[model samples]
Target: MIYQSFSSIANAGEETCLNCSTHVVWIAVSIDGGISFTDYQVYIKPDVTVGYGHQFVNVSVDQAGSVYLVYNDNHNMFYSYSTTFGQSWNGPFRINSSPSNTAIFPWSSAGPAGTLDVVWYGSSYYDGVNPPDSYPMTASWQVYFAQNLAATTPNSKWSQTTASGIVHYGGVCESGVTCTGNRDLLDDFGVAASPTTGFATIIYTSDQYVNSANEPAQPFGSGGGCTQSSTNSVECSHTDIAVQTGGTSLLSATTKHHFQITKTDFEQISNNPSLTIQVTNIGNEAINALTAQISGLPLNLPWTPALSLQPGQITTATTGALPATLLLAVGTIYTVTITANLSDGTTETQTVSAIYTLGAGIGL
Candidate 1:
């Protein structure tokens, strides 16, 4: 777990706060999947030059179990990672491609081995208001995204892009619960990767112009899906999802073939033996033809007639009734290989294990 807190001192064996200037991010690890956590350790403590210290500390763990840490320090986004869970870290790398006057509320999601995606609110101009201000931040802000396909590598180049249109025309205060200005955006938004496409999907809030007059919404004054009237002046905030259109996928596919085994069925009968496999096309492109064959049974099943499958479609290949001599042993484990041929001229292979029982059907 990660948190932000003021600095502390050991005053006669009692911990004492040392003022807000020493604010820092603390981290605690739970080896047992969060059942319990280790003692908190100071993770990030920015220098006095940045002032006000770091806020909104976030973390993400990749497929390889590397943990990524992100936070906003003096209007800039910074990140670090630990291959050792939280034991050791290896970064202080910057996330934004260009310098920004204000960047805050950073959130990150990890994907396939060594890939990570981050999103945060940012603006080219700084409103110049210190936290806990009575007014809202006045700088126009938009959601920004930074992706690193080789995140495990130190200082890997990050691909930066704008994730959303200007979300707000005014400034966003970073001083949670303290500043009174335009806190409609709250503190943070989040981002995640698509399981099949590997693309980054970000969910954020927006208060867009609602009526034809282009009136901004409430907090910005009577706009956004509202009827700009004395009684009906409140406009609802929008929860939006930004999908990445072009970029290297977080789902890193080593093979061009993008199909997956969805289901498999096996039957061990004396005279009516059958085995079927289901494959789903998960890629953006359609498969003109697909065929499959299974091996490791008493008799290897021959490849079935080639069939076509559209993107996101699931199709089945079956080895219909075979000769009675093609018997399967009950209570015996069998590791089977399924090879699929795609029209794209790529062949994909997968393996599965199955066991048959006298009454219970064959389990795959």
Candidate 2:
């Protein structure tokens, strides 16, 4: 199957203004390996300004067929995922770790199941928030990368780092042909992981300073011979690639530390309520040790006994019984977190929550 994403402009007038125009993201799924698409849907409607919001929309599918879509809006990167073949999506989660840096041209690539890598042009000085009509972009840009090893989990953590040196030192107007300032780096870049090595390779455009002599020069705006004004300099237009040197490999046949957690209530034992927590190794890899912890109850329980779980194995452990006399405040919620320690020296967690009512049973 193939997943594709693109952007569309809405509420356009004969002459568009920054606030008047809006941008949206659309997605399509192809079962025949991109030969033809049967389902086309609009995932996100026009919410932000048309210029930067919907630019550089990209999509990638993981080994398990989960689709990931990423885009930039308001100088920030947003990501969403779909597992049911584009029938529904999880979020428009902000993936950029940096709050102040400007993120643009976000591109994504899925590696192993639940693993994803994203690359974009990030700038320290330019937040890309100024009015479009007034050219307001000015800053130094670099290739920034972020990865989520457990992307399928809720509130997954993303690790971010700088992938390359300064690529450009100026304002980047993403306002298409009507851009007023520098649009030198163009629009988007690309990222992909090697199936064999599992390392990510990023292909991007660079405008870093390089003298006509084909050697390193000073910084772009620092009176460098290869400044943007010197259009003749080769540094003004060049393509470069960055390869991951040290990191976890994205290529794993078995889903790395992937599991599912389910909590079920058992009948009252000795007039005390009891709960059963089950964990299933849904991935191909076997979990070396599995444990669970429960919180938000009258009494919190520590980690449960470790259990080895093989692929497709489901194991259950009982939680401490709660006495009927114990008083739980209104709207009391119980949280169960299941953790899996993989054989590869990595750990993953899945959590479930249940709310307790006065007379009614626990609702998950």
Candidate 3:
């Protein structure tokens, strides 16, 4: 069931836009399993000048139906595979081998038939460190994940598996948007596997452009935006959505260790001021028990509840989590519920109603 379609993401679809100008084009999609798909394409740059169009393209399918793809250009991060399923595809492989400006999102996880489990979002490929000595010199982002067995060696078909599973974003910005300025958008994605314990799970999301009229938040790309230090930080990266899980067969599905919750009251609460918490447990193991609450607060001065979090703050917390360092209020006329454990083991639940103010607080 793989068949994705695209056309101007506000990038404008000028005359059908086939990879913008070619050079490298591949946004293809067509599968009949995940359910519904026939054919979609953009992939074409055999070489307008060295096949260059590599913009956000991701495709995965394994287990026997071979098909893998990845992207990211500016310096590196490219790979291709297709055992005739996608019609025919191969080598593009560079794997962030070198250069700079790195940013990959390659994702995959289809095992058994020939083994596959790719991942991305890198800044230091193999990690031996080179390029005049680099590793967080700017906005270093890392999440590397790998798997592509079903062989003996040759780099082992595909390798990486995740020597790193920690890349995050969250400088927060969304009311009027201005942790500094604006710019941040990552997607929420998923991939899973558990032959029994070969274990594998993934989640994604990233965006943190903290202020931009130009530069910093980047008015376009080419120049503008900095803060990566070996993996420095900034860009207000928030919108958090990253879950990781690896071989352990996911402990037989789950003996217990999952949880999730989200809240944001103001549906017409009048007052305005606090309450805004989010809880998650995408699973990779970890979430030993939790809790949260908020009945009302400050005489409703700024209204309060299961949201509005951080700024001055309120109360209610569990094993302790909302964003992590602290922030989870539960007051100001609202409701929130949470439940956990997932990634095989089982158990899941969540309740919500962070109400909204229809008059002065906005939400009418």
Candidate topping lDDT: 2
TM-score of every prediction relative to native: 0.59, 0.58, 0.24
- The regions of model 2 sitting more than 4 angstroms off are 9-20, 32-42, 45-54, 126-128, 131-138, 175-180, 211-235, 252-364
Q: Which segments of candidate 1 are over 4 A away from where they belong?
A: 1-23, 33-35, 40-42, 46-55, 127-138, 177-179, 210-236, 252-364
Angstrom error at residue 175, model 1:
4.0
Candidate 3 per-residue lDDT, tens place, 306-333, comes to: 4323322333432211223322332222
lDDT (Cα) of model 1: 0.60
How far off is residue 82 in model 2, in Å? 0.5
Best-to-worst ranking by TM-score: 1, 2, 3
Model 3 CA RMSD to the hidden true structure, in angstroms: 23.4
Cα lDDT of model 1 by residue, 67-141, tens digit: 787877656787777665466677678888554456778889987556789888877764455532222435567
- Per-residue lDDT of model 2, residues 1-364, tens digit only: 3466776554245135555433656676653335456444444454544433435678887755567888776467888887655656877787876632678778889875678999888766543456322323355678999888888776888889999877766566666567666666766479988865678999887766555453444444434446646643333656677889777756543443477553333333333455666666767777987655556324333324445677777777665455455554423445656667887788887655543322223221
Q: What local lDDT score does residue 257 receive in model 3, on the 0 to 100 scale?
A: 25
Clash count, predicted structure 1: 7
